[model samples]
Every structure is written in structure tokens, then in C-alpha cells.
Target: MENPAEVLRRVFGHEGFRGLQAGIVAHVMEGGSGLVLMPTGGGKSLCYQVPALCLPGLAVVVSPLIALMEDQVAALRQQGVAAAALHSDLDEEERFEIRRAMARGELRILYVSPERLVMDGTLDNLARREVSLFAIDEAHCVSQWGHHFRPEYRGLTVLAERFPLVPRLALTATADERTVDDIRRQLVLADAPVFRGGFDRPNIFITAEPRETERAQLRAFIKRASDGRGAGIIYCGSRRKTEDTAAWLKQDGHDAMAFHAGMEASAKREAHHRFARGDAVIMCATIAFGMGIDRPDVRWVAHTDLPKSPESWYQEIGRAGRDGLPAQALLLYGPGDIALGRHRIQESPASDEQKRIERGRLEAIVSIAESATCRRRALLRCFGEDLEEDCGACDACATPPKMWNGTVAAQKMLSAVLRTGQRFGLGHIIDVLRGRMTDKIAQHGHDQLPTFGVGKDLPDHTWRGVARQLVSRGALDVAVENHGELLPTDQARPILKGETQLMLRADTVSKASTPRESSAPERGEDPVFDALRQWRRDEARNQGVPAYVIFQDKTLAEIAYRKPRSLDGLAGVPGVGTSKLDKYGDAVLEVLLEAGA
Candidate 1:
């Protein structure tokens, strides 16, 4: 049997394992079942992929989406591995070819969707083969309480019941304590040791902005992120918003595309193909777009509306910086998002217990958004993991948001909510605070109230920001039963009575990075870097792969900086694996020599 380390170095192109990866790989190779919780790009696939290669038989990988399965299979095949995906998308001939390869014992890894795996006769056929192991990707989907729960994932438990002798490995990038427990119970991996790689993506600089002029904010962030350079994904809350955003970006002269579940199947595939193969394309999409995407040079990820939970937010942002380059995660959410999120929880058909748990999770997300300290620290702490100190990468750590004593603002919001009977929502209370003498106010006799117009000095968005912080801090609560009305909590008494001090962020987005630290190139570009990127783009196009799949931005940067003169010199760059070096060595050297001339 080939050693796992040899497989990693030769096939995957990495020198060695990172953190808990080696332990997990060895455990799986020793025929032990387990659960893996590693952040994206933390090499979760290697835990199972390496063991599958070292073992004797075919390893069945149960993935969530067909696109993801196909991407993994292609990337693996590029490394001289015999891997194939058996999803519904395959034609009869393709399916027959895969079956023939399997029957001939010519395949090492196979990817299948959970829906197809549980179908009748699928396992029976697999039982006839010498199955090595089972890998469940996106295992968190099995948790009914998770944000991205899939009903089909629950049926995966049969893998254990039917193939008890085969080691089963489940992997996910985002799962809170509850989600992890749920995954374990659902997957029936009772005795399997859980290997947690920690919930930290230091490569991604996280920031959140209040949703005032969200369109303009998103545009500015995307402009700074791509800067006519790398690719990115702009996540919207709705399909219409994605379409409109994509169109607007195209009008603004960006090479942008729109992707959503509402699009035609062929359109979706085309969009995916364009993004996977094209350069510097800004994909305006809903959350449904990125799950299975393997594009590695994504410079940033922006959310025009807030994500439902920290787990969802983490997973979305993790998509960026997969190549370990500096990437940005900019989230823009407004006061409306809070009410909408609570309303969603209320409207859900979940049991009261589930609703209460979801309500807590939503509040935690709000806390992270409104956090005044280091954003990365707050995010890690959300998953019950703590950072020893503040990380300097996040927007807050680099350039902290200016904060002001918001006690008076908090008091005013609480007073307005109370004086208005606490039955009205944020919009109504804001109207009352700003002295809007609309018919509703006059009809309710609220125009005559003393709190009316008392907060007129503050802008509506500013007051909304204040109210959002208060709610996040527990001074105010959304009354879901009464159509998202604002109500005072016990914590409100301290602020209302001037016993507790409050501070609110004055601005939404943090200061932009300096030219040296930004993902965008400075005005004066490095000729070698540009030349190498051009070469990589051309090579990727010829090979029908994403540019990052051929050579990540980080690798190109290293090659340019070193200006390697020989194939041996080029081989020393971190991302230049044996397969890539053997194929692109001469081309990279030529680009370097020409640029130096």
C-alpha cells in the first residue's frame, strides 16, 4: 500500500498534514469511524481521500450536491487518481462507463448524492463490491435544526446499519455544539471519535456594515475587492435582488453573472461554467450558488443582507481564501433583517423548543454583527471556541469602528417603544421618535406624546442602529407574536434608568485596507505577477479549469516574487505540486524569463 504522506505529496501536492488532519487520516486508514469538523480549505477531503487511496477497495463519498461531487471528482482525476461521480446528471453511457470501471476494480473513489445512495438496490450493488469506506460530506446537513438541513441526509444512517464493517467518516466546515451533537446522533457514529480542527479561518478578514445604502456599499466593496483582478461572489437574500445586482454590475462595466435556483437548469450550468473558467468574474448570486463551487482565487465574499446564523455566515465566508491568500468577508445588514429573521423563526413549523433554540442562535448572530471588539474573536467564540487574543486581520482589529456613548439613544428607543404601547414594530417606533406626523401617528394620538420627535436629532438609520444594538445586547426584544413589535426586556431597565452605559458603532463598514494589504493591486503593478497571472489564466482556459485550480494566486505571487529561473527553482513554491510542476514548469520559466527581459 502507498503511504498516505506519499499520496499527499505526489497527488495533492502538499508537503505534509496540517493540525489534526494526520491523526484523522491515520484513524480512518486503521478502519476506525470518526467525525471531522475542519474549516474550509483545511484539507477535510484528505482525511478520507488519502485513506481511500491507501486502502484496497473503492471509497464511496456521499456528497450533498451534484455540482460539488463533479468538481471533486475532476480535481482528483487531475492528480492521476481514478475517481468518478455517479449522480443523476450522468447520461446512460456515462453511468455505464462508471459501472464498468467499478466492476473492473479500476476506480478508487466514487462520489454520490445522499438521495441516490439511499435508493433501492444502490447499497445492494455496493454490497457486491469490496467497499473500503464511506465519507459523508457536509454532514451538518443531517441536523434538522441546522440552517442548511437536508431531509435526504437523515436517511444516511443506513450506511452504518448496512455496512457496519466499513469505516464511515463525516465531515463539515460549520457546525455549532447543537449541530455537532445532532450530526453525531443522526449519523449514528456513536463510538467514532470527533476530530475538531477548530472554527477559525485567519485568511478571511471579516466585517459587517449596517444596511444603509446597501447597493452602493456592496458596489464599493466589490470594486475594492476585485479591482479588475480576481473573482468574487456577491450573495443576496433574494433571487430578484441577485438578478438586479448582476445586471447593475454588468452596467457598471464588470464581467458579472447572476446565479440562483430560479434560473433554468442550462442557465445555471452555463453560469457555473463561466465562473469556473472565466477570469475576474463577479458572480451575483443567492446563498444557493456557492456550496459546490471549487473556485480558489475568490478574493472576497459580500452579503447584501444578513445571514440567518453564525454557522451559515462562517460557511459562506469560508468559501473565500481557499488558497490561503488574503480575502475579505463584507456583510451588510440593516435593522429590517433582525425583525425578518425573528419573524422567520416564529413562522417556522418547528416545535416550541426548536424555536427557542433558533431564537438564541439568531440573537448570537446579531451579537457578532454588532460586536464592538475584534470580529474574528467574536465569531470564533460563537462556536464555543475562544481566541487567546484579538486577531489583527478583521476590520475591527485593523481599524476599529468609532463608537459613542449611546445611553441617551438607548433610553429614547426604550421610551418610544414603551410610550407607543410596545405593540408597534421598529418602523413605527422610528416614526414616532423622529416626529413623523403621519396619519397612523395622528390617528393613534402618538403625535401628542412627549417622546415624539425627541430623537429627531438623530438620523433614522442612526436610531435604527442604536435600536439594533439594544436588541442585540438584550435591552430590547422583538415580539414575534405581535407582528415583530419591539418590547423591552429586563436588561432594558438599566439603560432606561441610566444605570448602564451603551456604545454604538457610528459607521457600518470599517476603513479600507491600505494598498499594501489589500487584495487589489496597487496603482503600480508588479510586471512579473501580472505576467504569471496572465499565463495562468491562459493555461486554465486551455485546460477547461478554473484559473485557481491550475495555480492559485498565492502560488503565482510566490513565483513572481522569486522570479525562478529553472524548473527546480519553480518547484520550491508552496502550491506547485508535482503534477502542476511537471506540466507547467517550462511555461512558468518562460514567463519569468520574458518578463525579466
Candidate 2:
């Protein structure tokens, strides 16, 4: 068998594996089954991608997302690799051609969504192929206990039962100890070696403010961050948010796109294509947008709302700096963001068990928000891993925000709820505090309540903060279908009856920092470099791994500018090593010197 380094360089155009990847490639190549819990941008895809190429048959990837398959396939084909996908998107003719190719061993890796795999027909068709490896992406979805659980992923174990001779690798960016155990049980990976990569990305810097900066703060953050060094992603929580943010960003003269599942399939595909080509510098999307996106040189990943789990947070942030170059992660949390999350959970149609699990997930997210300790420490601990390095980049590291004991404000907000019969959302409650007797106020007859205008002593913004803080602390619950109809949690009973006291937070607005451009070397907006990176990413995709594992953006820029002429010359570059010279050495060098890399 070829050495791991040789295989990596030849297949992925890289000199060697980063972190646990070399070991992982070795294990998988030796016919070992394993579970890989690598953070996003940690080179998780390469563990199976390179080895699968060296092996003789198809490395069937049981993916939980179809968009992921499309993205990977498009990337792979761009790099001149023989790869295809068998998902619902393909027509019968397309599926038949792909199936024929798989049987003939023309395709190295074929991706299929787990929901499609669960069907007898789809599994039966793929079973006829000479399968060598079975790689499961988003393995956490196999467990119902995971933050984003998918019921269909449970059928993946059927592949193991059916293909006893093929080696397997289950991979995920998110999973705690319990979720990990659940994944093992569901996917039946008892014998797989476990490779857990550390969860810290040193390049990312985390900072948060109260929810008060919804539009204004977001606009300010975007303007300051887009110094035009490289592309970044701004993750919003909903479809509407994505559109609104994307629109606002466009007005600021930035090339941005809004991507969500709510968009038409054609529109989504176009958006993906644009983002992949680096034609757009920023994407304001829901979580769905990042899964299929394996782009390197994504300078940053920011969140406008709180993510549901540390696993999810790490995965989202992991999308940046895949090339191991410096990048940034900006996590913005508002008190209302927490409340909205809780209210939705409390209103879900889940069973008792599901509700309990959901609550646990919510609490875990809160722990990250409330953590005055190292953010990385809290995040890694939640995943059942340890962080030896203190993250000097997050808010906790730079300057921790002082905690607000909103006990009095909580009591006042709770009192308003009790007096108003607990039927209002934050806006109405705020109005009652500011004593604004508007038409809606009169329509609801809330103006007559003794507490209607009692909150007049506090500003509208301060009142809003108090109510949101109360909800985040669990003294109140917002009804789901009714949309933010406030109700008292059992904890509020003591405060209501005077058995316990409450405090209100006086929300403070921080002074805005002057906007500054990024300090990175200015890479000009040359279409040739953009084209070369897209070409390189395409090659990486067909091989079925992340593009960063193939070549970094800096290296891509070097190739685009200098156009290295020989293998020896290629090996002289910063990221290039001996292994890469042998495998992708000639091909990439050709593109660099002449056309595309």
C-alpha cells in the first residue's frame, strides 16, 4: 500500500494531513472502522476522501443533506475528478447513468441522503456496486438526542449490516458525550476507533451585546468587518432575517446573498454557485447554508442569534479558517434571542421525552452565554472533550461583560404579566412600561390596569431588557403558537407571591468603535484568482473532502499571482510539501503557471 502521505499528496494535492487526519487516513486505509468527532474546518472530510481514492472501489457516503452532496460533486468535477451524486435531485435518467457508473467503478465516491438510503429501492441499487468504504457525514443526526436530529439517519446501520466487508467512518462536527453514545447505538459503530479533534479555533474572536443591536448593531458589525480581505458568512436564524439582512448588506455596496431552505430550489442552486465562485463576498443565511459549504478562506463566521448547542456553535464557527490560516468568529447574543429560543422550545409539539431533551440543549447553549470563564473551555467541556489552550479571542478573554442581577426588573415585568393576565409579548409589555397609551393599548384595555403605566419610570429600552432578562432566567415562558404570549414559569410563583425578590437589569449601550479596515494584505479582485480557487475547490470536491485540505487561500493566491512552473517550484511555496508535489504537484502547477489551479 502507498504511504499515507503519498496518498494524501497524490489525491488531495496536499503534503500531509493536519491534526488527527494522517492517523485517521492510516486507520481507514488499513480497513479500520472509526468515529471522527472533528470540529468544522478541522479537515474532517479528508479522513475518508484520500483513502477512498487510493482504494479500488466506490466510497459510498451516507449524507444527511442533499445540498451537501451537490456542493461536493460540483467541486469534485471542477477539479477534473470522476465523481457523481445519487440524490432526489437527479432525474431517473441521471440516476440510471450514475448507477451504471458506480457499477463500472467509474465513480470514486457517491453521496446519498440518508432519507433516500432508508428506502429499499435506493439501497438495493447501491448494494450492487463494489463498495470499499462507507463514510457517514453529520453522524450526530443518527441520534434523536442530537440538537438537530433526523429520524431517517437511523437507517445507515443497515449499510453496515448489509455490507459486512467494507470499512466505515462516521463523522460529525457536533456531539456531546450522551449524543456520541446515542450516535454509536443508532449507527451501530461499536468497533470503530474514535478520533476526537480539539474544538478550539484560535483565529476566531467572539463578542456579544444585548439584543438591542438587532439591525443597528448588525449593520455596524458588518460595515466594520467587511474590510474586503476575504469572504465571510453571517448566519441569521430565519428566512425573513436572511432576506432582510442580505438586502441591507447589498445597500451598503457589499456583494451578499440570502440563502435559506424557503427559497426556490433553482434560486438556492444559483446562490450556492455564486457563493462557491466567490462572486459574492458574504452570505446571510440560516444554518442550512453552511452544511454543504466547505469553502476555505472564509475569513470569518458570525452569528446574529444564539445557536442551540455548543456543537452547532463550533460547527458554524468551524466553517472559517479551514486552511489553518487566521480567521475570525463573531458570536452575538441578545437576551431576547435566548427568550425566543426558550419560548419556541416550550411551544414545540414534542413528547415529554423530547421536551426534556430540548430543555437540556437550551440549558447547554445558555451555559456558553453565561460563562464568564473561558468560552472555549465551556464549549469543549460540553462536547466531552478538554481544552488545554485558553482561547484569548472571545469576549471572556478580551473583556468579560458584567452580569446584571435584574431581580427588581424581573419582579416588575412579572407583575405586569400578572396584572395584564399574562397575555402580552415584549412590545406590549414595553409599551405598558413607557406608559404609551396607543390605540392598541386602548383596544386591549390594558391602559386600565394599575401597572399599565407604572413602568413609566423606566425607559422603553430598559423595560424591554428587563422582560427579556426575566424570560432568559426562566421566570417566564412565551407561548409558541400564540407568538410570544408571556406566561409564568413555576419559578415565577415565589416572586409573584413575595416569597422571593426580583431584580431588573438597566441595559447599557456600549460606545461604538470607529470602523476600521482589515489588516490582511490586499488581494486585488482579480477574476483569474477567483477562477483558480474555484477550479482547485472543484478538484477537492470530486475527491470528497474539504477544499482547504487540498490548498489554502494564500497558496491559491500565490499560484494565481506567481504561476509556479515546476513540481520542485510548487514544493517551495509556503503550504506545499513533498507529498503534494508527487500527487497534485504537476496538475496544480500547470494551472498556476498557465490557466487555473
Best by lDDT: 1
Write candidate 2's Cα lDDT for 315-416 as tens digits.
Answer: 788887665655666667765567777767777898888778777777887777656567777777777777767666665666644555556566777888
TM-score top scorer: 1
Per-candidate TM-scores read 0.90, 0.81
Question: Model 1 TM-score?
Answer: 0.90
Candidate 1 lDDT over 281-400, as tens digits, reads 889999888677777777899998878888889988898878777788898876667767887988899899999998888887888888778888888888889999988777678777
Model 1 residue runs over 4 Å out of place are 414-449, 456-461, 473-524
User: lDDT of all the models against the reference?
Assistant: 0.83, 0.73
lDDT of 1: 0.83
